[model samples]
Target: MLRFLFDTIFMVKVAYNDAPQPWQLGFQDGGSPSFEGIVELHDQIMFYLVIILLGVGWMLGSTIRKFSVHHNQIVHKYHNHGTLIELIWTITPALVLIAIAFPSFKLLYLLDEVIDPVITVKAIGNQWFWTYEYSDYVNDTGETIEFDSYMIPETELEPGQLRLLEVDNRIILPVDTHIRFIVTARDVIHSFAVPSLGLKLDALPGRLNQTSVIINREGVFYGMCSELCGILHGFMPIVIESVSLESYLLWLSSQNSPPYSPLQKPHQFPKLGNPWGGIGTPSRGKRFYSTSSSSIDFATSSNEEPLPPLHPWFVTGLSDGESSFIISINQRGNGWTVRCSYELWLHTSDLSLLHRLQSFFQVGSVNLRKSRPMASFTVAAIDDLFSVIVPHFTNYPLQTQKRSDFLLWAKVVELVHSGSHRTESGLLEIVSLASAINRGVSDKLQTAFPNFTPYKRSLIEPCLSGLSPNWICGFTDGEGCFDIKITARGSGSYHQVECRFRLTQHIRDKVLLELFISFFGCGKVYIRSNNKAGDYTINNIPDATNILVPFFDKNPLHSSKLLDYLDFKQVVELVKSKQHLNPEGLSLIRTLKASMNNGRRAKD
Candidate 1:
C-alpha cells in the first residue's frame, strides 16, 4: 500500500509542467495569473477522483466482509431498490457533477476574457523557425522594430542555457503587465504553446489569432511547438524571459546591435487612395516621420478662419484628425537627441486654419516647404509643448481613438519633462513607453532598443459627451464613411448610380450610429444582415449632395478617404446633372466611379 501511494505521488510529479521539477506531482505551477486557476481546477478534479476511489473501495470491501454467505442464516427477499438509496445514488452524483462544474466554468471564462494589453507582440510560426515582432513602436523617421528569434544550435548553447530550448534571441516580456500575442503562420499550421503561461494557440495561415498573458513572476519559461511542423519541429523552442518593467526597458535599449544614426530617415509614404478600402499611413507619418520646424508654412489663405482663435476643444478635435504627436530620435550636431513633437498638416488651402491653430495654441510655428503644396503647423520646442499644448488638452481632452495615444504621449512628455531622457534608466523607460503608442511600436525602435519593453496600452474609449462639428470630423477621420454604389437591374440594364453615405458598426455599438443622426441632422440607422450589423445610412441624393458634400468639402478629409471622397463627390455631381441619362454621360460617371471605393467590382 505504501509503495502504491509512493508510485501515485510519482505520477503526480510527472504531471507537473512548471519546469519538470524533481519529485514533481501534477502540473507545473502556472507562470501566469490565469494558469494558476487552471492548476487549481486540475487539483480540485484530482481531489474528487481520490474521494470517489476511496469511498467506493471502502463500501465494496465492507459489504463483502459483513454480508458473507458463511455468516448469513437467511437470505433477504429478491432485491428491490430502496427509495433512499436511489435518491442518494442519483442526486449524489449530480451534486458531485455540480461541484466539479462551477470552478471548471469559471476557469474557462477567465481564460477567454482578453484584457486590454499594453504591448502587442506578433509571432509568426514557420516550417522550421519563428519570427517575432515589435512593429507598432515606430520611430520619428517612419521606422519600426522587428527581428527574428531563431533557435540556438546545440553546439552554440551557453553553459547554463537549456540545450534545445535556448534561442539566439529570447522573447522578453514585462512582469505584471498584460501582453497580447498575435499569432499566425507563414506556411503550414503550427501551435505556439507556452505551458507555463497556460497559453497554447494555433498559428493558422492568413488567420490572426490572439491570446493574452500576464506573468506574475519573472523567470525564463520554456515552450515548444506542440504541433507536427516538419523536420525542424524539435528545433523550434520558445524561450520567454520575463522581467520587471524597468529591467525589461533597460534590456530593450541594449538591442541596437548597430545603433541608428540620426541621419538615417525612412521614406515618405503615398497619400490615401481609398479610405473605405484601407487606411494607408496615418495622414502622413504623424506617428513616426518628423518635419523640420523651419519648413512649416505659416502663410494662412485669405479665406482662412481668422483668429479669436479656434476653441481649444475645436483644436483638440481637429488635431485628432489632422495632427500627429511624434516621439522622435533626432540628430543635433554630432549627437543624437530624443524629443517629442506635435504637427498639424494641411493642404496649402487650409494654411489659414493652421495659422489659426498656431495663434490659438501660441506655441507652434507654421511653414510651407518651398515646392510642396502642403503647409504645416509644428511645435518641436520642448518648453512650449509642456506649457501651452499639454495644458490645453488637459482642460478639454481629445475625444477619439487617438486619446489613448495622447495619454501615452503625455507620459513620454512627463519623462522628457523631468529630464529622464538624459539618464540611462530614464531613456530606457521612454523607449518602453514609445514602443506602445499609436498603431504600435515599429521595427525601428526594436533595433534601437535591445531591451525595449512595451508598457500597458492606453485604453481608447470614445468620447462619452455630446458631439460637435470638429469632434465629428476627428471621429470620422477614424471611423466615418462615404460610399457610392452603381447597380444593374434584374434585366441586366444599368440603373441610376446610387450614392450613399454610411457608417457601419457591430450590433452592440448601435448607439454610435444613433448619435450620427443627431450630428448630421439627417440619415437613419438601418439594421443590415439579419441584425448582425448596424449602418447609419443616407441614400437620398439631395441630402448627400446638398448636406454631406458641403460639410466635407469645407472641412475636408485629411486621410486617404479624401481621395475616395473627391471621387464620390464627382459621381454625386454627375448623377445630379442627369449625367446618367445618356451613354456618354453614363460612361463618364462609370469611369469616375470605377476609381472609387472597393474598386470597379464593388461599385457595380
Candidate 2:
C-alpha cells in the first residue's frame, strides 16, 4: 500500500505542474520578480524552519527510544508547562514574523510608487480593439500617427503561434524602455494587462487610469482581455513586440502599408424565399428609396422661402435667392431719439441711374399717435435737391447730406434698419449695407476674379528695384483695372485723373498689377474709393518721379496719352525716387511683381 501511494503521489505531481516553475522561483536577468530585496530574511526563515523540523524529529526519536528501553508503558505523561520555556517559544515565533513583515511592507510601498516615465502612450479601448497613440515624439511638422490593433483569428495564425495569442498588428516597443500608458474607453469598460510585465490597468469609460511598464525582453509577448465584455469579448487579444530602437523605427515605417488577409467563406444571410424571410429585394429597395426621398423632401421644405432678384449678398456669391437679410428693432428704456443710416457702393459708374434708383425712398415726418408717414418725398432726385422721404419721421431727425456723404452714411442707415429703426435711451442702432456689400463682394471677387492686379503688383517691386540702372521699370502685361490716387505736395496742384484699364484677361490683370506694384516698391496697396465718384486712390504712392506721374521721355515706346492714363505708375516711381515708400509699400510691390511671373502660364 505504501509503494502504491508513493507512485500515485509522484504521478500527481507530474500531471499537475501548476506550481511555481524553476524560472519563476527566482528573479532572472531578464524577468521581473515579485520582490527584489530581503533575500537574507527569506534565507534565514528557511534555515530556521529546517532546523526546527530536524529538532522535532530528533526529540520524537528520543521519546521512542526511551519507550523501547523501558520495554512497557503504553502512555507517557509530562509535568505542567514552564513559564520560561513557553515565553521563549512564543517570542521566537513573533521575532520570525516581525522579520518577514518589515520587508513585505517596504515591497508594498515600492509597488505603489510610480516613477517618472520617459514616454507616455494613450490607449483608447474600443468594442473589441485597442487604439494606441504616442503622446510624445511628434514629427517635425507636428503630426502624429495613431493605429489600431485587432486580433488575428486562429486559422490565420502561423505554425508555432499560440491559439488566441495573435493580433493583426502587435504593439511595438523598444526594449528596456520605461513607458507610461494611460488607458480609457469610449463605450464599455475594458482592461489592459500584460502578464509577463506584471502590469494590469482597468479602462473605465469616460475615465483615465495610468500604469507603467519597463520591457526587459526583446521578443513577442501575448495577453488577452481580462474583463468579460460582450459576446465577442473572448476574441480580443493583445500582442506586444519588443525590439531594438532601430528595428522598432523600421517596423513603424513598414506599417504604413496595408495589412494582408487570408481568404474566407462568403458571409451567409437569411434566405428571402422563405415565408419568415428577414429582408427581401423589394423590401431593401423600398427602404433605400424611401430614405432617399424623405431626405430630399426634408431638404426642400427646410429651405422653403420666397426667392428675390438680388438676394442677400454673401461673401462668395448671392445668398440662395432668398431674403438673406434679417431686421430686429426694440426700445430699451424711456423716450429716446433714434437715428438710422444705411450705406452701399455701386461698382458701376452711373450716378444718374443711382439717383433714379434713389427715388424709391421718400422723406417724411411722423406724429406720436400715427403709425403711417405724415410727410414724405415722392421723388428722391428732384433737380439739384436730392431728397429721401420717410413715411413716419416725426420724432426722427430730417438728416440729409451730399451724395458722397450719403454713400458713406448709407452704411449706418443699413445698421439702423437692421436694428428695426427704434432707438431707446443710451442705445444707437445702425444698419450697414456697406459691411454686407464688402463681405459679399470680397467673396465673389476672390472666386470670380481669382487674381487681383493690385495684389500682384505688390509682390514684384523689390526684385526689380534691386536690379542695376535707376531706370523706371514698369509694364502693362495686358488691360487690367486698378484703383489709383495721385497726390501732389509742396504747392504743386496735381490734376486728379481717373482712368479705368480694361485687362484683356484675368491672367494679364494679375500679371500687370503685380509688375506695377513691385516696381513701385509698395508692400500692401489699398484700393480706396474716397467717398467720391470715379476717383479711387492707390494708398501707397511711389516717390521717384519728378512730377507725380510716370515720365514718357524715358521710353521711346511710352505713349504720352498712355502715360496720362497710367498716371498711377508715375506717382509710384516719383515716390520710389524720393525714398518715401515705407516697408509695407515695398513689400506690396515685391509681392505683386512676383505673382505676375509666378502665376500659371496664359492659356494659348
Candidate 3:
C-alpha cells in the first residue's frame, strides 16, 4: 500500500511540471521562488482549514452524543452558561485568521515588489497570438529583437509537441536573473499568465501592466491566455524557455545578425548550445523584407509568411505622435474642391512601420521621396477617412494635444462624408476647422478663402486620468524633449549642469500639458512669454532621476528619440554622482549633449 501511494505521487509529479496534463488536479511543481512561496502559503492555509474542519466536526459530534434525548432525558444547567468555552471558541477562530492574514499579506507584498531587473521583455497580446520584444538590447541593425509567437496548430504539431500550448517562437530568458515583463494588448484585454512561475499580468489595451519573475530552473514553461479576449482567445498560448546566460546571449546574437528579418518566423531557433534544442517550423505569417536601412519591400511570394495585424489603439498611439489630419482645398475650374485626408510622415528608416500602418487601415498609399529620407502615407478618399479613420480614433481616442486636432479634423471628415463640403457654408466650415488643426490652413488656402474666420475650437477637456502608458510614450516620441544644459557659474570655472525633461505643445492645449504633471506627479507647466507655446518641464534633478528616469526606463521610447533619452539619462546620472564637476565627466556630458535630438541627426 505504501509503495502504491509513493508511485501515485511520483506519477503525478512527473505528469505535470511545466504544462497542464489530462485529469490534473494539482498545480505544476513550483518553478520559481515566487511560485514556491505561493505553494507554501497554500499549504499553510490548507493546514489551518483542515484543523478548523476537524475541530468543528469533533465539537458537534460531542455535543450531539452527550446531549441527545435517547441518551439522557434531563438537560444540564451548565450547558447554556459556559463563559470560558465561549471565550475559547471566539478567540480561537480569531487567532487562526490572524495567523493566516500575516502570511497572506507578506506574500502579497513580496509578489508586488518588483526588484531592479537586468532584462525587460515586452509582451503584446494580439487577438490570437503574442508579440515579444526584448527592450534592453538593440542589435547592430539598430532594431530591437521583436517577433510574433503563434501557437503551432494541431495539424502542424509534431509527435511530442503539445497541442495548443506550443508556439513557433518561445520567449527566451536567462534563468536566475531578475526579468521584468511589460504586458499590453494591441486589441483587447488578455492576461499573460504562467502558473508555474506564479506570474500573471493583464495585457491591457493602450495601458502597460508589468510583473517580474526569476525563473529558478531552466526549462520550457507553458501558459495560456487567462482572460477572454476574442473567439480565438483559447488558442493564444504562451511558451517561455529559460536558458543559461551564455546560451541566451548566443540566441540574441543569432537573432540580431544581418539579413535576419524580424518579420520572418524562424523554422528553428539556432541550437543555442542548450539542452532544449529548438522549436518547430516557421510560422505561416510574414510580410515585410528589409532591403536597406531606408526601404521595406513587401514580400509577394506565395509561401511568404504574413505579418500580424496592427492593434487599433497602437494605430491611435502612433497617430497621436507622428500623424497629421489635413483639409485640402484644391482649385478646380470654377469653385474649390475640399478634400479631407489623414497623413503620416516618417523617416525612410521607419518605412516598415509605416507600411504596417498602411496595412492596418487598408486604405492609405505610401509615397516615398527619391532625394530625401522621407515617406508619407496618405489616406485621401473621403469615404475611407470617414469609415476607417474616424471610427478608429473615436474608439481608441488619442491622449495628447493631438486629440484636439483629431476632434476638429473628425468634424471636417464628417462634413465631407455627409456631402456638406460641396456647399459654400460647408466649405467655410471646413476652412475654419482646418485652421484649428495643426498649422491650420496653408498661406495659399488662407489667401483663397478671405472670409474664413478661424473656427472657435471647442475646448477639449484634457484626459488627466487613467492615461495609457503607451499613449504617453507615443505622444512623447513626437513632442517630448530630454535636454541637458551646462553653464559656468559666474566667472568661476565651476560648471552647473541643468537636466530638464520637457514636453511642449501649442498654448491652446496648455491644459493638456497639465496631464503630464498629473500623470508623472513631477514637472511644472510653463507657458512661453509669447503665449504661443507651453512647456511641461521637470527642472529638478531629483525628479528627473527618481520619477522621470524610472518611468521612461519601464515605458520606453521606440523612435530615434530613444537615443536622445539614453544620453539624457546618462548625463543625469553623472550629475547625480557629482562627476560632472570633473573635467573628464564634463567633457563626456558635453559630447552627449551635442549628440542629442537634432544633434544626433546632424551627426548621422
Q: Quick one: best lDDT, which candidate? A: 3
Sort every candidate by TM-score, greatest first.
3, 1, 2
Stretches > 4 Å off in candidate 1: 1-18, 22-24, 63-77, 80-83, 140-143, 254-604
Question: What is the TM-score of each predicted model, taking all chains together?
Answer: 0.40, 0.33, 0.46
lDDT of 1 by residue, 244-290 (tens): 65565445434432122112222232332321122223432223223
Please list the Cα RMSD from the true structure of every candidate, rounded to 1 decimal place.
26.4, 27.9, 25.4
When sorted by lDDT, best at the front, the candidate numbers are: 3, 1, 2
Q: Where is the poorest 10-residue window by lDDT in model 1?
A: 257-266
Candidate 3 local lDDT, 177-236, one digit each (tens): 777899999998999999999989999999999887888788999999999998999998
Alpha carbon deviation, residue 418, candidate 3 (Å)? 4.7
lDDT tens digits by residue: candidate 2, 1-604: 7756987878643232111234676622222232223344456667778877888789889877877747756554575578998998789889867876776687656545545555567887778888887655442112344677877787788986667667776788766555678889877988886666555678899999987666654766666677777777777777777786446544543432211111111122122222112222222211111101111121123444422221111100101100012222222223232333222222111112122223322221110111221111112111112223222111121111122233333434443445543543112223222223222223432443333232101122123332211112112211123334333455643323222232221221233334444544443333334522221123433332432234333431111123223443533553455423454554444433333221211210
Candidate 3 lDDT (Cα, 0 to 1): 0.77
Every candidate's lDDT: 0.69, 0.40, 0.77
Off by more than 4 A, model 2? 1-89, 124-129, 137-145, 184-191, 202-207, 227-235, 251-604
